[model samples]
Target: MIVVTTPTGRIGRHVLGHVLDGAEKVRVIVRDPERLPAPVRERVDVVRGSHDDPGVVAEALAGAGSVFWLIPPNPRAQSVQDHVIDFVRPLCTAIGDHGVERVVAVSTLGRGITRNAGLVSATYAMDDLIESTGVHYRSLCPPAFMENLLSQVETIRSRGTFFAPISADRRFLTCAVRDIAATAAALLLDGSWTGQDSVPIVGPDLLSYEEMAQIMTEVLQRPVRFQQISGEAFTAALRRAGVSEAWAGGGAAIMAATDRGTYVAEAGSPGPTAPTSFRQWCEEVLEPAVG
Candidate 1:
């Protein structure tokens, strides 16, 4: 049996879809089972409650051979570190009790190099805590998501401008969430691999926000451009967008670190690289969001 957390979310739903396409026995932990599409409802068993709840996870993981885990964002939480760790503590016990054989989790980049990286640091902590359980684990590490651009879709369409806290010319590698989901789905289906490892889901292009704007301009037929903002201003913007003050401040810290080149991919990767290109993401994802 395979258990999936956050099964209705953007990436998780896709993971569930790919797994369901195969012959694995599947169950899902969801806050609201009704949010699942009707077809998904008919196909899978579900435990309705937050996955972090001990009972929910225990019930979901019962007799399950593999687990696809994702910590759903809590933008309103008072503390980023506490939020992620608190959720993981329960699951660590459950994984041990259930004797699950394999685990796949979504984590971030900058594992060893990034310090005081706010939420990213918390994700690294999560990896440590889960791995200590001795479950065969795979950490799906991706940099900034290409879907983040969708947050600026309205501005890109109406004003042809988007905002960022990072400088225009600093290059960073990003991955499409589709690629991340694809990796998770593939791992969940294969029970042969053992031990712990990090899978870096890096897209093929290294791009700056300026290059991203140029691509969006060409793909969406709009003169999109990046406008840099102050760190505090970016935090305030995040708050205005509905994230709590603490979460927004952590986000600001991540932006500051990114601008300082803390997130630049190593000259040659030491892990797996995904196949999607930045321009391909623009044409497929950004263009549709703009429309």
Candidate 2:
């Protein structure tokens, strides 16, 4: 059986869909069964509860051989690291208890950097904790998500301006979540690979927020601009928007590390697992969202 956590989430939903296309038995751990699409609800075994709960995880993992693990984003969590640990600890215990053979998890880049990159560091910690259990694991490491720009769709449409905490010219790879899901689903279905590895889902372009804005301008036929904000300002904005202090600080850290060139694609690493380009993403995703 293949068990998927966060099956209704932005990335998870896509992962679930791709996995369901295969012939394997699929089960989902979700907080609310109603959130699942009607057709999807008809197909999989639904264990209705947060994956963060031990009982719920154990219940879902019973007779399951492979697991798709994703920590649902929690902007109001008191502590980012602790929030990740809360979910991962149960799964680690369950992996040992259930003898689950494989784990495919969504993690971020910046695996070995010395500086503290809040959410990135949290994901690294999660990798370590899960690896300690010795389950065959694949960490899907993608850089900044292109869909993150969708959050500024309103501002981009109304004011032709979007904001970021990084420098305007800082080049970094950005990935599409669909690409991440494709990689996860392929791994889940084949189940031929072994012990542990990090799958880098990098997009084709190495771009800056400024280049992205330019692409938006050409694609959307308007003058969209990139506005750079300080990390402090970024965190303060998140706080003002009701995100908890810890999560907001983590956001700042991610941006800070990005600006410091922490997420640059390394030499001779595998080619872009996430093949979506910035222009393609703008034309396909951002343009539709703007409309």
Candidate 3:
């Protein structure tokens, strides 16, 4: 049996779909089984609770061979590092107790390219803790999610503008969440790989906000503009959007790092690059969100 965590989340749902179709006996640890689609609920064994719980994880991992892992964001937690560590410790214990064969997890870029990046640093630390458990692991490290652009749909539709902390001239790296899920599903279905490693799931395009604005304009058939905001302003915006101060500050710090070119999309990633281009993502994801 294969176990999946966060099965109703964006990437998790997609991973579950692939696993279910692959005809693997699938089990999922979810807080609310009702959130799962009717078909999904009927198809898999469900442990109804958050994966961070020791009992919940132990129950889910029982008799499971491979696991798809993802730590859902806890923006309101007091400290990002503590939140992730608290969530991971139980999984570490469970992994050993259950003797899970292989694990795949969602992670971020800039492992060695940059240091002291708030959220990035915390997530890297989370990966380190999981790897120390000696479970065969694959950390799917991707740049900022292209889906983040979904948040700007209203602004793009109304004012023809969107905001970012990065400067217009700086080329930013991004990854489609679809690619992340696809890669994770591929890993989980296959049983051949061993040892520990990281896969960079960055998309092929390297774009500046200005260039992205141009593409959005062309794709949407409406004028669009890039508006660069200060780190403080971005942090405040995130705080207003209900991100905890610490995490919002970390997000701002990450933006500052990216703005400075700390992760230039090609620094530490030497593995498989995702096939989706920014334009394709915009056409497929952003345009639909805008509509």
List candidate 2 segments past 4 Å from native.
Answer: 266-270
Backbone clash tally (model 2): 0
The sequence of per-residue lDDT tens digits that candidate 2 reaches over residues 1-291 is: 999988989899999999999999999998889999999999999999999999999999989999999999899999999999999999999999999999999998768763688888999999999999999999998988998888888999999999989999998878999999999999999878899988888888888888888889999999999999888889998999999999999989888888888767668544576778889888898898999
Tens-digit per-residue lDDT, 199-290, candidate 1? 88888888899988898888888688899888989998889888998899888888888887765867665443888898998888888878
Error of 2 at 68 (Å): 0.2
Between 2 and 3, whose lDDT is larger?
Answer: 2
Error of 1 at 56 (Å): 0.4
Sort every candidate by TM-score, greatest first: 2, 1, 3
Q: What is the clash tally of candidate 1?
A: 0
Give the alpha-carbon lDDT of every model. 0.88, 0.90, 0.88
For candidate 2, what is the lDDT? 0.90
1 against 3, candidate with superior lDDT: 1
Candidate number with the higher TM-score (2 or 3): 2
* Local error of candidate 1 at residue 165 (angstroms): 0.4
TM per candidate = 0.97, 0.98, 0.96
Q: After superposition, how far is residue 111 of candidate 3 from its true place, in Å?
A: 0.8
RMSD of each: 1.2, 1.1, 1.4
